[model samples]
Target: MDGKTILPRSEVPEEFTWNLSDIFASDDKWNEELEALKAYPERMAAYAGKLGESAKTLLDWFTLSDEITVRVSKFVQYASCRSDQDVGNSFYQGMRSKAFSTAVALNSAGSFEASEIMAIPDETLARFYAEEPKLETYRRSIDKLRRRKAHILSPECEKILAAAGEISESPDRTFSMFHNADMRYPDVTDAKGEVHTLTDGTFVPMLMSADRTLRENAFKAYYKRAGEFRNTYASTLDAQFKQLKFFADARHYNSTLEASLDVTEVPVEVYTNLIDAVHGNLGKMYRYVELRKKILGVDELHMYDVYTPIVADADVEISFEEAKKTALEALAVLGKDYTDVLEEAFSNRWLDVYENTGKRGGAYCTGNGWPHPYVLLNHKDNLDSMFTLVHEMGHAMHTWHSCKYQPVNTAEYVIFVAEVASTCNEILLMRHLLGKTDDRKQRAYLINHFLDQFKGTLYRQTMFAEFELQMGKMAESGEALTADALSAKYLALNKLYFGDTMISDDEIALEWTRIPHFYYNYYVFQYATSFSAAVAIANRILREGESAVKDYKKFLSGGCSKEPVELLRDMGVDMRTPAPVNDALSLFGELIDELSALLG
Candidate 1:
């Protein structure tokens, strides 16, 4: 497949398609299960107020909830996979909508279960566990719910909140429809006079173009359209923020950030530490920008020029099969078991590979019930794509291990620790590639790639995180989150983060309009923190070999059984302290030095 041409979903080869039938053999079967799931609300409602009856009754309720969870998970996974394959497919779209509605219905009806369990005294719960030994299996989950007792509303209030679940997502849904479905960009002519349609999917690649004129044109053209709908985006964002505040206030949280991080028991200091550490190291970013300007031989560096490859002549083309082998070789440091999981992911058709018409852009690994974790990739045959292959494989393998080792209740890891596994794979892959090659040019290319990761994941994400914090604070403080206010704040942050090395274009201010993560309260900081954690873990694995590998495996398998920070600490990285962040930045400085030497 050519980079310029996207095949339709039906035209893609079967081998590249995920075996979704592993979950349900056919759509009819999916429909059957979906219909059966409708009765789950009634079944779950039957156990309401009965959780405190006895240990046997409590175990029965847990079993029933698990059964509903398994069935609903399968239904939602199948529908989501189908819809993602082609967003325009109405059948799958309806299926996805229905699945969501059913989930909300079940949640609304089952809201009493947690409140009732929370009503049980600690002594009584312990006695119940003693009376029915099987209840001990759910002790951790029960405790987790108990920890939220302070935030738990009355049963009626909980029911009302649960019923409003679908309504709460309106802003996000509206923005998604506007961003993906309605908005369109004009065609921009490249330096060669070839016209290309500017789209969300093609915008990044265009920015990464070596042709400065093309990158600038695409940047302006894409944002110019976004600028047109600035009010719409701002309104959507405003609504989202208001919703966050509503939930926070309703749950008695001091602030929205507190509400967001409280779910995972993450301390606010982790977020603050990332911003402070990155700000302290802004000189490194400024130096990188200076290097970019010097290497590209441009008198003035602009935001649009930031993404182009510094080692343009060293552009590496890696095919899918080649990527698979490279990822396996790189990850073999984790020993045979981890490598075997990667093998299963490839051989078992666990991935839906390649970009096709109407397919979702970007990549992710999603785990549902009992089926193998599924990975979605819009794979382009380039160095970045190869790294993405390994990155997503990292996630797939994490899901595989966690799902294999833990029960349904604790199988899903929290987002705070999720990126560690994926980013760790990426770091390991880069080290493996660098180790395997001594060619100065290739090494320089790899180092440049590594620096880009640091810039994008560590520095850039921290910048976004800071901007998000400010926005949330402003909203909480009654400041209007108008387009002007958001854009001005973002621009100021850009100036502070980039320093004087690059020109901060006014259009770059509109970047907040395009980031969907802003709608996700306090989520982007995890990328920065997770990348730092990965750097520490990967270095340990490379330096200490088997011992480090064992700990890393344990971190992956622990899932949500323990606090995320504690889990990372067990793997020898304490994100609470500034050590990991500083260590990662120090490594960045070393990479820059090596690249400088190689270039000379």
Candidate 2:
């Protein structure tokens, strides 16, 4: 480990950690709940063949199912969050596995529900709804199931699939273990001969270093280490896609993408449309890449150079306290209700701040099931980390709003719109920073930051989206996803997205091995789409003031109560059209112009 010491979980200050006691008072309490939950799956088995018996029977099943869901969710969340806090801890990992097994058993027990519901005639369901007043609460869920009647397999088949759930998670689990727990990155050395610990948490920060040697060395070492295990990574990725294709084909979906999108009610066109929009605007990305090379005073811009600040003087450290204060100030436009919850997040131990030994890399916000929205950050004192603080707080707030407004069944928002609130917060933060600074250098720095967001969130994620699409199709066509094949496709994408200015270093091709998102099953595309939607919404909030803020919050609170596209449409950005993506890229083009002028 370099000069920095990542504290053990036990040594981390109590104030800096999230309070898991909010979910369960202690490990004993969690175990007690686990034992109690084990009996309920058998109870669910009692309702297996009885869903279509009558209105009361169906209503009773829904009540029982929702209760189990909430409890099991809390059970799984606690164990998984604990495990995430320290991936090296076997006790928590065992607990998490048990939780998953319990969930799988419960799923198997309830596997008959969907098919039975689908089997009900339209007229019978309507009659049941009329008979049971409370059944109206699940009308949307019921209707959605009915719509997918074609996809719902026989009850016996569903039971088999349900049983396979835990086993099917093998690829993701394997990769997670490899990336977080098993893989070891070599220590990188700076020009001064000082060594730095290179880890998942430290890799990006090293790339952001002002020292060119350190950046290049860290970049080479990190990817080179990953490249060594390329075949193993490729096998896991192959299994992931194959599993997706298995379920897709089993469910009678024409393609894996179709199956994935169907769950969210998103049209396939939305996915293709995003790529089409980004492809149309490649020139903007190319121009930005060219400008980066010019500003960095480098003849060749390597992959390692991409993250270092083009406006070097503006790169500065931002303490955690400063991050929280600036986040509150920047997000004040979101009104009192949002800020109130945000304030609680800062003070109430809702965040597990700072990196620790064996802690998971990156940042995320989870509710650990309702009433407690938690954020995990490998927090560094820098502008990027400040933006990360606000970004995750956005997710925490969205979880807070959705849970407060929507019922349990519909509270969790789909992946499609999940990134909107987070990215919108980022855009707002950038604008806030830009507006407060009169100094040309500061403004250029902020603009560069915004441009980088466009590059990373918009351009880079779309490239990832493209790679995913190609891989999925290749899998469907029976093409093998070997390490060399994956790396070639990934490198080509890097070249295309970064334009001819980028070196497309061979080390970067191994990047697919490191991405946790590929296992997410077509999840990265939404980052680009969400960034587009956020650009539009952030601009509206800034322009229209209270009315826009009101609508934006409404969208956050809406959850899955309405279709995601409809919810966004209600807020004025329509994902059904290409306008949002085009508008976002237009802003990217304008920002490049703005940054160029400022630099001049």
Tell me each candidate's TM-score.
Answer: 0.97, 0.98
Q: Residue 475 of model 1: what lDDT?
A: 80
User: Candidate 1 on 307-343: residue-level lDDT in tens?
Assistant: 8888888886688898899898889989998888789
Residue ranges of candidate 2 with Cα displaced over 4 Å: 1-5, 367-369
Name the runs in model 1 displaced over 4 angstroms. none
Q: RMSD, model 1, all Cα superposed?
A: 1.5
When summed lDDT is taken over every stretch of 10 residues in candidate 2, the lowest stretch is 1-10
Backbone clashes under 3 angstroms, per model: 0, 0
Candidate 1, backbone clash total: 0
TM-score of the candidate numbered 2? 0.98
Residue lDDT tens for model 2, 1-600: 111458988988888789888889999999999889989877888888889889999999988988987898888889888999999899998998998999999999899999999988888888998888999888888888888989999999999999988988889988888899899999999989899999999999999888999999999999889888999999999999999999999999999999999999999999999999999999999999999999999989999999989988778778788889999999999998789888887887888898898998899998543656788998888899999989898888888898888778788888899999999999999999988989999899889988999999999999999999999999999999999999999999999888898899999899899889999889999999999999999999999999999999899898788888998999898999999999989999999999999998
